[model samples]
Target: MKKQSIKKTPAKTPVHGSKPALARQVRIIGGEWKRTPLAVLDSEGLRPTPDRVRETVFNWLGHLLDGNWHGVHCLDLFAGTGALGFEAASRGAAQVTMIEHNTPAVRQLEATKTKLNADQVQIQRSDASTWLAKTGAGTARFNLIFLDPPYHQNWLGKVVPLCQGLLADGGLLYVESEFALTDSADSVLPEWMTGWQVLRADKAGMVFYHLLKRQ
Candidate 1:
């Protein structure tokens, strides 16, 4: 489906050190926390996946999830709003770890966790690339991973291979980028993706979402 744009009045700029206006909320579409609202902080480059895009991604994952999503472990590497991680936890993922370097984002994640009493989710304030490099698959492999880093930073180039290493056998990785993967000059795939294969790909407005699996 072609994504539609929602028109809204421009937000007023906040003064330095002043409290920023409340950003819009992102709602979980399924599982225990279905319809629950998560605050999206007004951080620079903060873009939560669009509702239609997330709905499509989860639909692609539905069959694999089974009934309770038992024994599933997930990682949200960029974790701007903890949306993916929290949604996985709500669906009964054994554990969901969210990693974000932004302090306010981390605080909001903690607040959401506390609000939902989500014991199965862990929030870490750290650079996603550094953390992925430091952590080994043997000690911390995840069955599902979400990668939605700031666009145009070459972050995907650095993190995709690390996520591939961190994924267990048959694991899945979901990525969101500003350009479609088919456009090579615009979106470059890493050379180390020998074990990686695209499972699904779709475009939502200007954003491209992909689901991959490690073979």
Candidate 2:
């Protein structure tokens, strides 16, 4: 008896020639861009701030500024997905400068800016530390600054001090970290963080987020 021959199925090739993984998206939680979804790239250590956390942060800021964003200038030092920066721009920030070192992330930011017709938003591809150092003091000042650098890098220690000079008087600094900058008696405030006073703080899962002001 002849053994039955096994048939091999041909592998199916993707129609799009190796399509990249579908980008994850996060939405703008408030302002004119409310509920607008922006694509998020899967870069190493890139964690977009959570929606609930962002809502709480913006709420705190709104209360502090009495819901006025007309003259606000915002700096997003580590703009992973432009979530924070775009949100500020949507809320009527006069200018929003988003710094992202990742090439893909920067391109995505530009695309989103164009899609939104965001003339007030500027995207810069540069290392956050390098940008901070080169920008220096008094050259530019922002009413709000978002610092959500990659975790475990001690980025807060490096850039927090520089932010002081770049921040306008009465400006607010928003930070997201793996560890709490405040509320830990065991944690000594780093010299760079000493000048900042935590205005509002809360934890969401592994993230410790805070809104601070210069002392």
Q: Largest lDDT belongs to which candidate?
A: 2
- Assess every candidate by TM-score: 0.84, 0.88
Candidate 2 clashes: the total is 0
Q: Can you tell me which runs of candidate 2 are displaced by over 4 Å?
A: 1-22
lDDT tens readout by residue for model 1, 1-215: 99999999899887788687766988897899999988888789899987778888888888755554779999999999988888888888899999999999899999999999999998999998678767864668889999999999989888887787788888899989877654376556567555677889999789989888977
Q: For model 1, give the RMSD to the true fold.
A: 11.8
Q: Cα lDDT of all candidates, in order? A: 0.85, 0.91
Q: Which stretches of candidate 1 lie over 4 Å from their true place?
A: 1-22, 183-192
Worst 10 residues of 1 by lDDT: 181-190
lDDT of 2: 0.91
